[model samples]
Structures are given as structure tokens and as C-alpha cells.
Target: MIDFNKEVDRLGTYCTQWDYVEDRFGKKNLLPFTISDMDLEYPDEVAQVLQQRLDHRVLGYSRWKHDDFRNSIKNWYSKRFNCNIDSEWIYYSPSVMYSISKLIEIFSKDGDGVLLNTPAYNAFYDVLRTNNRKVIKSPLKNENGHYSIDFEDFKEKCKESKLFILCNPHNPTGRVWTEEELIKMINICKEYDVKIISDDIHMDIVYGSRMTPILKVAEDYLDSIYICTSPSKSFNIPALTGSYVIIPEAKTRDRFENIVRYRDFVNSPAILSVLATMTCYNDCEYWIEELLNHLENNLKYTISYLEEYLPQLKLKMPQGCYFAWIDFSELNIPGEQFQKMLIDIGEVAIMNGHVYGEECEFYLRLNVACSRDKLIDGLDRLKKTIDYIKL
Candidate 1:
């Protein structure tokens, strides 16, 4: 079993989450919690496999044997979610969002309506806007601490848009949508003929069993919907190879592929990274399960600690992913102010919520996928800083 309590030093690992904090956050040494990457190393077994592949020393162009890649991907979804995925329906892309941009080109036209839930992964907004598509914002309603979809508003907005870019197990808020929720969401999009482009990057690492895929929840075979997924976030293999784009509809899939003809984005990583990602899916199953349990423990402990000692700062432990959407509105500070205060004063780095949407002015996202001791230390620093400033 993977050791959940183990800590790997990432301070100078040339990481966006760790190494980039100084230039990005304007602090010489910031206590960073802003980025989505985990501060832990990949499993030793996985590392060994990659190192073995690296021993060949010649890094050159790679090709997909097709079947080998398909089996690894199909097996992951079938084993994890019990959803049947046809390998024929899968396409290759370097990054999930890169494909999302390509889908915007395929499914949507300039001046066409594109809808997004507010408080998304910032990149979603950037991609849509870069393509000159009109972005429609449908903000989720905050219920207590966790946020839920406003179905009524979602339906109305979907009616007006031709495409919807959805974030499953949603970013910033961390809502692991249930099957019922996914269907209701899809049905509404279907009614308006909106193509559902779901970003299922965070499909794994869920803390609860209630969450399922948008396709499973979607009643009937809604060919218009697109499932863009990757194992990058799931296994911490973003620097590795590619992502999967599953489109059940032949016509739509053809259109997506046609969009790719004008550009050259089918860049697969080194054969080593590809093999490593596939290996993680086929063999690292046990490690993922153990990691989820440990992360859930961290989320629960952090929430309880905040409630008992730092009541002014509100945090809702999510049902999926390693993110915690924290509300600091009670502290009467702006999101950036709180983020800077956390770094400058509390010595803890965290995400500023404003970039997600205007509605996130008082929220910040924190990653709890660290060693238990690091998480505890970060929490204690946050508590003292927030409380000390409260007076």
C-alpha cells in the first residue's frame, strides 16, 4: 500500500505548485497551496518502471499501436465506474483542455453561444474566449458550504447556447455530481440541442461513491455529448502523455477529427511516459484507493479543525478530489487580500478565488493532497493568522 503519511520534498522540484510560487505569488518563499498538483512523488513502483524505460536514453517520436493504448483506457473506466467505453470511440490529444478548444471549434462557431458554469478552472474561460465564442455564465448556487447546480437556471441557459463545457467533480467547488444530477443536467442540454462537453479529469480520487459519469446519467444514447478525460490529474502524470476524447456519435467524432486535420496536435509523449500512464491504470489501482482514503481523512480533519478553532473561516469538505473550497467572507476581506494575507502573514499559500468567477470573491481553493503533518501545519498556520487578524 502507498504510504499516505509519507512526505516528499517538492520545494525545488521545478514544480508549478512549489517552485513557481515565488515569482507567481510575489513572495520570495511563499507557503503555497494555490496550484492543483500534489506535493508527493509518484509511487516507487511507477517511478521504477519509468526509470527502466528511461534507460534506453533515446527520446524520439512515438506512435500509438492503438490497441495497447485503448485497452489501458477502457479498462480504467470499466473497472472504476462500471461504464462501458468502446475503444473505437476514443481519440488522442496532448492535453484535455487542448482538445476542449478543438471541440469548441468543431461543435461551435464564432458568435455561437457557449455556456460555462462560473468558478471553473480559469482555462475554460480562456479557451472559449480565445476562440471568439460568446461565453454564457450560469453560476451554481451555494448551499450551506458546498455548491449545487441551479437546474432551473441551467436549463434556461442551455436553451440559449449550442455547447456546454462542464467540469465533473467540479473545480474550485469540488462537487462530485451524482447520477441523478448528471442526467438532469444532460437532459436539459439535450432538450435545447446543446452539445455537452464534459471535462472528466477529476473522475478518480473521489471520496464518495455517489458520483458517476455524465454519459451514465444521461438517459438514452445522447450522441451529441462529448467526454474529455485524462489520467493526468488522477495519477499525477500530467507531464506524461495524452488524454482521451470519447465521442459515441460517429458524425460528431468525425467532425472533431476533421477539426484536427487543419492543425497538428496529436503529439504523444515519449514511449516511456505512455507506458507509465498505462501501467498506472492497469496495476496502480491499489495505490489510488489508498490515496483517496488518506486524502478524505485530511479533508475531514481540516474542516473540523477550522470549525472548532477558526470559526470565522468556513470550509466545506468535498465528496471528491483533493480540493477544499474555503469561504473567508466572514473575515470581510477580498479573495486576493486573503490569499496574500495567508502567504504574507500566515505563511500559507492558497488560490485566489476571483479568477474562477466574480461570485468567488471570498473563496479560495486549498489542496489537501499532502502529508498529514504538512496539512496539519498548514491548517494551524491558517487558523492562527485568520484569528489574529479577526480582532
Candidate 2:
């Protein structure tokens, strides 16, 4: 009986989610529903393994590849996604963002168009802009809270873009890309000669359905895809900063590896991160199952709560990630204004949707990866703020 109900005091551990809220917003005691990191404690099994490794105290420079590391990754994908991953395809990275940035630099050039669906993970925009690549938005249609990609528009955009970063189990929106949808994307990218960098960090967080890896579809089109994934998001060990990139083609993999080497970004991962990752993939299935159950219940509660009390707020329940993509347009307030109201009156921190891309100004993305009591508290504050506005 793991205690998902126990509220961990995360205030003083230099936590960005909790400790930095005051600095970022000039508000103390703000209920943060903003960052994607879960509020739940990490699995004890992983922690125990990490501690055991730390006790050895050899902390010297280490290597990324080992039989155990590769086997753990292979087994995880096999057991979870039913996807056969050739161990030869796996290459280590410090993080998913690092891999994406490196791949962006390798595959595309300054001013080359990087296609992204609007209301994407906001960090992708930062990565593109910082690298001097042009961001091409192929906006996802928000048809009354359900989000779907427009294939025609997507294809048109792909014609001009060099790379497409697909977020399966998309962040903020939480729409898990179906196999049919993924195949459609692959076909379009194929026709346009556009390469794909799939950020699958959230691959293991699906609620009821299994995650579909783009690599599974990219077998025939191996040269056109790069799959980036990490256990950080799945196992709550992001601070450990360990992730891997999967490149199916030997030439492409060599090219990527060469870039990593030339750029001096190659180094052994933190020993603890590797150990924790191996422990997680090999030993944490029960913990993940429990977490999925808890998150699904939270999703259901959020939907029912919105309907019962705040009908003006439309929620498209996420199929995978813990984020709830909520439409607050019925309140007739701008995204900034709504965010201001939430911060000032409600004192709740949520990511405003507009930052994801243009034309998402009426939406707010709430991180529901916390305990029920905290969730309800945030909801009550939201309700109170809405009621006050109505008055």
C-alpha cells in the first residue's frame, strides 16, 4: 500500500515546482499545478537500488552502455509497448531536450523550418528559436475540447519543414496518438522527405491504452526518424538527467554519434541515474501500475468536478499524461487575464496555453499529477475565483 495520499514537503529541496513559485510569481503559498513533474514520491525500490549503489562510493567516471542497461531498456519496451527494439539502435543522451537540440542541430540548419503542431510542449519553441530554426506551426484543431491534427494542413506544412517533432501522448493536451494517426503522420513525412524527432518521454504514462512509439512505424523509413525517450518523466527521476535516442539506421546513428562527439557533449551519465533507470525498468512495474490507477481516478474526478461545479470550464480528459487541457473560453476571458485571476485571487499556478503556440489563448493546462486533496483545493480556489467574477 504505497501512500499516494501522503503529501511530501517539497518546499525547501530547491524544487522548481514548489520552491521557485514564490520567486517566479511573487506569491507565497501558491498551489502550483504548473510543472509536469509528479508530486508523488518516487518508488522505494528505485531509491533503495540507488542508495545501494551510492554506498559503494566508487563515484568515478562511468560508461553508459552495459549489458544490464541495454537489457532493461529492451525488456521495458518489449513488455510495455509490444515493440521489438534492436539494442543496436539505442544511444545514450543526458536528457530528452538535449537529444532533441542535438538532433535539431544535426539534421536542420539555421532558418530551416521545424514543423510543430500548435499548443505543443512550449519548450520545443524555445529549442527551435534558440537554435535559430524557424518554427512552422501546423495547428491542431480543438473541436470542442477534443484535439486532432489536420492532415491536409500537416502535409502542407511538412512540405516546407525539415524536421517534425512528434509528441506522442502529447503534453498539455494529453491526446495519445493512435496507430492510425501515427501511420498517417509517417506517410506524410515520407512524402515530404521530412525527418521526425519523436519526443516520447511521456510514453509510459498512458491511462487506459498502450503507448504507440513512432519507431514502431518508422521501421521501413528508418532514416527519417529519431526516437528520444527517458525514464525521468515516467519514474519521477528527471533530476537524474538520463535519456536515450533510438536511431534505426546505422549511418544516421553514426552521424548523430559523431555530432555528439564533435560537440563535446559526450560524457558518461551520472552513475546513480543509470542505476536508478535500470532498477525502475526492471523492478517498478507495480509502482507504475499504481500510479496509472491513481492518475486515472484524478482525471475522472477533474471531469466530474468541472461538470458539477464549473460547467463553463470544458475539460478534455487526457488519455496519457497527467495534464488536463481545459478550455476556459466560456468565461470569456483572455488567457492572460484568466491566469492573472488564478494567480491573484485563486493563487493557483497553471501553464497558460498561449505559450504553447499562437491561437491557444482561451486554454489553460493544469498539471493533475498531485494528490486528490491538493487537486480539490486548487479546484475550489478556481471555483471561488469564477464565482467572484460572475458576481
Candidate 3:
């Protein structure tokens, strides 16, 4: 068993979460529970594979269109999700966002409506705005901390949208889209003839539920659905910089490949990234199981701690991912001042939720994918912030 409680120092490593807290929070040495990446170390097997590759001492261009790379992904889907993935459907990209950005550019003109749920992954907003696509927001209905889709609002927005981006096992809120949810969404997009891009990057880190891939439910609507996913979040290797998109339509796949190869000139995956993917998917299943258990324990601790001390702060145990979305609206604190206090008085660097969407201004996203000691310390700091506000 992996000792997840063992703390590994990440300071001075140029780490975004640890080393650069001041950039976003305007305070150095604040305890940070921001950033999606984990503070925990990646699976040892990934490091082993990378080291073995480096020992060969020949870092050359590497193609990802081979049996080993494709089969690893195919086998992972089959074994983990009981879903069959065709070898032809898998295509490599540098990152999930890159694939999404390119797909938006390819399918939609500038100013065309691109629909997504509000309080989304902030980077989605960045990508859409950078490409000059109009963001069509469908606000999720949150009832007593449980979030659900407003299908009526979603369908109405679909009519105006050229593309719909789905975040399966969604970030921040951590709602694992059920198979029923996926089918409903797929049918809506199909009815409107809107292209779908499902970002299932958090598939492997689920709790108490199975992650239904968009392709699983959109089998009939395969031509319009694209799945952009990677092992980066599950394995905590974003720095390696590799991700992929699963496109079922032949013509669309060819067009995307053209842009990736000739237009963008990004033909090969990073040697270390592909090796890490293969190693993690093929040999690190045990590590993932342990990681999930650790995260679940952390979630339980967070829920209990909040209920005991900071009961006014509302939170629901996430269905998946390692983030706890806590509602601070009950405290009646203005979003901007509350954020400032968290930094100045509490000396904690939790993410300001307004950045995700205007509706999220009263919320804060806390990262729980750390050692229990760090989690306890972060929670104490959060409690300190709340106590100070009450004074």
C-alpha cells in the first residue's frame, strides 16, 4: 500500500500550486488549496518507465499511432469502464484544451455560440474567449448543494450553439454525469444538430459512481460527439503535456488530423508523456485504487470538519474528483472582501469561485488531494478565516 500520508516538499520546484501562490492570491507563503493538480506524487511505475526511456539515451521524435499506445487506452476503457473503445477512434494531442480549442476553431466561426455549463473549468472560458467564440452559459440548478441540469435551459441554449462542451465528472462541483444524464445531453445536442465535445479528463478519479463516456451513450450520434481526455489528472502528470481526443467520424477525424499535422505541425507526442501514459494505464491500476481511497477519506474528513466547526459553510461530498465546493453565501460575505480576508487574515489561498462564473462568486473550491496533514492544516486555516469574519 502506498503511504499517501507521507508529505513530499514541493516548494522551490517551480510548482504552480506551491511556488506561485503569490501570483494569484497576492500573498507569498500562504497555505494554498488552489490549482487542480495534486500535491501527492505520481505512481512510482510512471517514474520507472520514464527513467527507463531516459537510460536508453536517444530522445528522438516518437509517433503515437502504434499498437502499444492505442491498445493501452483501448484496454483501459474496456477493463475500467466496461466500455469498448475502437483503436481507430483514439488520436493524440498535446493537451485536452488544445483539442477543444482546435475543434472549436474547426467547427465554428468566430462569434458563433459555444455552449457550456456555467461555473465551468476556468480554462474553458479562456480558450473560447481567445478563439473569439461566444460563450453560451447554461446555469446549473443547485438544490441544497446538489447540482443538476436545467434541461429546458440546456435545450434552449443548444439551439443557439454550434458546439456543446460537456465536462464529465465535472470539475469544482464534482457531479459525475450518469449514463442517463449523458443520454439526455447527447439527444439534446443531436436534436439541435450541435457538435459535442466531452472533456472526460477526470474519469479515473470518481467516487461511488461509474463515469459514462460520451461515446458510450452517443453510439448512434458518434459523428457529432468528440471525447477529449487524458491520464494527466488521474495520474497527476500534467507537466509531461499529453492528452488525446476520441473521434468516431472518419471525415471529421481526417480533418482534425490535417490541422494537427500539417496546419499546427504537431505530429508526435512527447516521448516521456506517451511512455507515462502507457505505464500508468497498463500497469498502475492498483495505484489509482489506492489514490481514490485516500481522496475519499479526505473528503469524509472535510465534510465532518465543516459540519463540526463551520456549519454555516455549506458543502456537499463530491461524486468525483478531489475538490470540495463550499458555499459561503450563508455567511453573507461579499465575494471580493471574503476573498481578500482569506488571503490577508486567514493566510490561506483557496480559489475565488467567481472566476469560474458570476454565479459562483459565493463559493470557494478547496483541493483535497493532499496528505492528510496538509488537508488538516488547510482546514484549520479555513476555520481561522471563518472565525475572523464572524468577529
Best prediction by lDDT: 3
Model 3 per-residue lDDT tens digits across residues 1-391: 8998999899999999999999998889999999899988999898888899999999999899999999999999999998887999999999999999999988999999999997799999999999999999999999998989999999999999999999988887999988888899989998999999989999999998678887887778988988999999999999999998998889888999999998999878898999999999999999999999999999999999999999998889999989999998999989999999889888999998998999999999999999999999988988898898777
lDDT of 1: 0.80
Per-residue lDDT of model 2, residues 260-335, tens digit only: 7665667567878888888999999999999988888898999999999999999977888988888888899877
lDDT by residue (tens digit), candidate 1, 265-371: 46444576677767888888888888888888889998898888888878877878798788888888767767777877888787778879988888878889888
- Whole-model Cα lDDT per candidate? 0.80, 0.88, 0.92
TM-score, one value per model:
0.94, 0.97, 0.99
How many pairs collide in each candidate, listed in order? 2, 0, 0
In candidate 2, position 274 carries an lDDT of: 85
Ranking by TM-score: 3, 2, 1
- Candidate 2 residue-wise lDDT at 13: 91
RMSD of each: 1.8, 1.2, 0.9
